[model samples]
Target: MSGLIGKKIGMTSIYSAEGTVAKQIPCTLIQAGPCVVTQVKTTKNDGYEAIQVGFDDKKEKNTPKPLQGHFNKANTTPKRKLVEFQFNKDVELGQEITVGDVFEEGDFVDVVGTSKGKGFQGVVKRHGFHGVGGATHGQHNRQRHPGSIGAASYPARVFKGLKMAGRTGNKRVKIQNLRIVKIYPEQNLILVSGSVPGAKNSYVIIEK
Candidate 1:
């Protein structure tokens, strides 16, 4: 699949007109590139085929020496995000791929990003556990507790992979089949229907 590295600008609602009816559609705003092609891999060269592009600028002094040379080879400045996609099109180094070039209104795409972190959470919030059903019947602070985890003597130890409280979110998530609602080519912005993972200004990948 071909994709572009982008940043999640935020989310908003737009009015979509269907005949005489106006419907409100919630959408996520993403700045979908103006990415520069940094490298192109081929089966004979790198044992596979892919296109590597860089998005967002960074200070040259902050970039490592080897990475600086790599960016220099592509005739581009140091970038904060670098992503590789299996693009079938031929592109030269330093070629810029913008949102308009890859996606259009009404096109469906898949967005990949890191979801917002929730830190350590209980089973009720993390795994949707109902917790203790009643507040009565000696259920004091046991409401949000995980209750019993293991059997008595038959299986003394708790089973692995059981749903339990743990760190939540801050993980890679892919939202598939998100329709492209609109495009602002000059602004390098794309509006995708429905919600996308990640916090505002976080990096995302829009795949077709």
Candidate 2:
């Protein structure tokens, strides 16, 4: 499937006409593409068929010497993000792929991005654990604590993959089957139904 590198431009609510009813749809806006094709791989050479595209501009001085040569070979400026996608159509080096050329309204796409970091979180927020102690009877300290992890005698230590209070978010997450509500070619913006992972302006991979 073909994909594009895009940035999350926050979210907003839009009204959609469903037959006679006007429904308020919550969607996330994304600025997709105008991506440049940096490299093309073939089965005979790279043992796979894919195209490497780059999105967003990067300062020339900040780019490494090797990457500078790579961009030079494509005859395009350095990019901040480069991703490979299995493309079915014929693609050439330095070809510009915009949002209009890739997707249209009512199309279902998958968005992959890094989730927002929540730092150190408790079980109530992280694992959705109920309070260990009740609100009454002066039991106020263990409200948000993660009751008991495991057996004390049999299992001496905490087992692996146990849900506990720790670091949260800031992980690669993929939201699948998101319908494209609208597309603005001139502005290079696309609105997808529902929320997407990551913070504002963070890079996301939108795949069809």
Question: For this target, which candidate reaches the highest TM-score against the unseen true structure?
Answer: 1
Clash count per candidate: 0, 0
Model 2, residue 150: displacement in angstroms? 2.8
Q: Give per-residue CA lDDT, model 1, range 64-178, as digits (tens).
A: 9999999999999999999999887678888988887888889999999999999999999999998977889878778888888999898789899999999999999999999
Clashing residue pairs in candidate 2 are none
**Cα lDDT of model 2 by residue, 1-208, tens digit:** 3889999999999998899999999999999998999999999999999999999999999999999999999999999999999898898999999999899899999999999999999999998888687877876788998887878787688889988989999999999999999999999999999999999999999999
Indicate the TM-score of model 1: 0.97
Candidate lDDT scores, in order, read 0.92, 0.94
| Stretches of candidate 2 exceeding 4 Å from the true structure | 135-138
TM-score of each: 0.97, 0.96
